[model samples]
Target: MKIALLQMTSGIDPDVNAATLETAIADAAGQGAAMLFTPEMSGLLDSNGARAATQVTDEVHDRVLARVRAAAAREGVWVHLGSLAVEGDEGDPRWANRAFVIDADGEIAARYDKVHLFDVDLPTGESWRESSRYVPGQDTALVNTPVGKLGLSICYDMRFPALFQALSGAGATILSVPAAFTVPTGQAHWHTLLRARAIENACWLVAAAQTGTHEDGRSTYGHSLVVDPWGKVVLDMETTAGLAVCEIDPAAVDDVRSRVPVIAHRRAIPVPA
Candidate 1:
């Protein structure tokens, strides 16, 4: 299957972002892409928790999601709406950072809430407390798609190898890690972490990324990537708003795992006294 990774620099406006995503989707479909993947916060990027929360609505009422779902059905393609900011609960100050998988019929097949929140104080003088505004997901998501068996995860989730292991154990052959990584962390650990995750699990890692600066006064590292089961970066997107389209064969997953058999050689660690 041919998948397209959309790299975007979205502002704090869901409408505009939806339009951008629509165009990308059409273009991708025009180029014969079977599946299209987007980055985190694809709807909006906001620094103000209040404004961000207000802009997000319930998933059923989110216009961007509705539009993209319609796009998937119209284009006869599958879509991974990487992650969207949506209203969480009644009276709760926080919202949900959620990902959705849309089938060719424009129906939501699976949804994954991001489990690992990005709460860090970076040396670059850029600090974030994502847990403050967003609620963490309690469960991991593994779903089936036309491309392969998918394991869902967001940006910060990539740092936790255990999550990937759990997904792999649950029969996930393709891992989706869409991120809006900060410039500093992206520069330091982005590629390495992604490569490590793919090598460790021997799974195809497809990551769509956010690039450049947003209207929220923040910059992001924008190297969207697709790593094969053997940890080969077949496609690397530039630091701009564009599509990185590549073909992925699921048979490679079987071949790699057959050779390495790492997942089968697992042993639990012993507790120390």
Candidate 2:
């Protein structure tokens, strides 16, 4: 299947982001891309937590999501919208970091809420407390799509290997890691971590990233990558905001797994004395 990874620098405005997404979706589809993947917080990216909270809305009420769905239907292409910061359903005012898979018919096929929250103080003097603003999700999602079985995850989830292993075990051949990585962390760990996940899990790793600086005065690392099951970097968008399209062959997963067979090599460990 042909896939397009959309590297973007989204701002706090949902309307402008939606318009951008629609155009990319159309362009990708016109180029015969079967699916389009976007970065996390593609709908809204603002440095101020309070402003983001107020600007982002629930999934049903989010015009950004609605617009993407419409574009998906019109273009007849599958859309992995990466993730959207949305209001929590549990009466808590904090929003949820959620990723969605919309089918060509514009129906939401799968939804994965990001489990891991980023809360850290970087040496670059950048600090974030995501838990204070967004409620964490507890489940993992692997969706069946035309391209292949998709493993769903947002930005921070890339740091956790266990999640990718579990998704691969659950029959996911293509792992989607849509991210908005901070400059410091991205520069240090982005490629290495993504390659590790792909090699260890024996699955295709596709990460569409948020690039450049946003209206929030925050800059993100922009190196969107498409890794093969064998951990080879097939396509890389280096600090550019554009579409990176590549073909994904499902057979490659099986071929790599047969050669390495790490999953089958795993053994359950008993509690040690």
TM-score of each: 0.98, 0.98
Model 1 lDDT tens row, 12-52: 88999999998888888999998999999898988977677
lDDT of 2 at 71: 94
Question: What lDDT tens digits, residue by residue, belong to model 2 across residues 23-61?
Answer: 999999999999999999999998787777678878889
Cα RMSDs of all predictions? Answer: 1.0, 1.0
lDDT of 2 at 239: 98
